[model samples]
Target: MKFFIKLCIVGLYSIPFAYLSVQTDYEADSKTNYIIMSLIIGVLSYFCGLIRADLPLIFGNIISFSVSYFCNSIAMLDKKRADFFTPINSVEQIVLITVMSIVIQVIFYKLARRFAKGYINIIESNNIEKEKRV
Candidate 1:
């Protein structure tokens, strides 16, 4: 139950990140591509929290960005692939996305640990207490 709650929290946070990312390239990336990016980011963040590895902020962002780049790359259709890769501004675009990912993940890491430690009230472990009161 705790795991699910944490996952959901991260997932919820990702929606804004996706929106901001799309704003960076409103003409370039479609809505569906960013939706997939949000899902991937949430799942990666969840695993990073579970691993509790050393330097999680550094490691998690690196892994998350690498996966997202590939996913975003693949999400592009064949017709756009050639035009997308050769543009002079492509490097600039990637850099912006990288920075956005870092900012979002860093904020999540700061807040998620605090949220996960407390009782969220979204889940009730004992219905028995309410039943007895009734």
Candidate 2:
């Protein structure tokens, strides 16, 4: 259930990008690329959660954004647009996305932990009642 919730969160985060890709006359290939990138980010978040108490969603987003930026710059060069990477248009984009991802993941983690604890408590109570009957 926790994994399902996490997957939903990931899908929600990708929606804006998916919509933008469609609105901007983006090539089908580029749209597919973005989807693949998002999946990679989701997988990275999952692994990060395994090692840490909470998922480092913000860190994963930053890493994903940086890689995407680098790739975009390279693509621009291929088209003879620029020789180097351009500065990001909005620092706020990074801050907003990072904050949102972290907050959402933290909330989900807390809820999942609470649910798991409640499940264990119920099981323990049931065992205790059984023992009492015996």
Candidate 3:
């Protein structure tokens, strides 16, 4: 049960991480922004994982950088149909992407945490009911 709960929490963090990392348009001027955003996400996920002392959480958070970079490269080619290494030529683009990443990260983290809590509550309630019946 604990393992399952841990998996759920980690998944909650990762699924969106993969999606958004791929979706971001990293140009030269905005590459720094991407790196900074990645670092922030990495830190948030790392702490969230540490909440349970789970192995998967620790490793997943650690590997978040490579995961995001891989997804970004793949998405650049497959989804956006753009070249893999487009540099951000403008400061305006950097600011826009950075702000957008921050907002999206905040929203996703809140939702994932809420979902994990709700899931644990349901499982715990079920276990209590079973114990009472026994």
**C-alpha RMSD in Å of predicted model 2 compared with the true structure:** 8.3
Residue 88, candidate 2: C-alpha displacement in angstroms: 8.0
- Between candidates 1 and 3, the one scoring higher on lDDT is 3
TM-score to native of every candidate shown: 0.43, 0.44, 0.38
Candidate 3 C-alpha lDDT tens digits along 6-124 = 67656644543433533453333234545655666555544453353346554544354345555554554553345443565223333454456555555655666777788799999
Instruction: Judge candidate 2 at residue 56 and give its lDDT.
Output: 35
TM-score of candidate 1 versus the correct structure, residues matched by position: 0.43
* lDDT (tens digit, per residue) of candidate 2 on 1-134: 66765555444444333223322323332446445534544554544454433433553354545554444444444432232213532233334444554555555555556666777899999999999999
Which candidate do you rate higher for lDDT, 2 or 3?
A: 3
Q: What is the lDDT of candidate 1?
A: 0.52
Model 2 CA lDDT for position 119: 75
Poorest 10 consecutive residues of model 2 by lDDT? Answer: 17-26
Clashing pairs in 2: none
TM-score of model number 3: 0.38
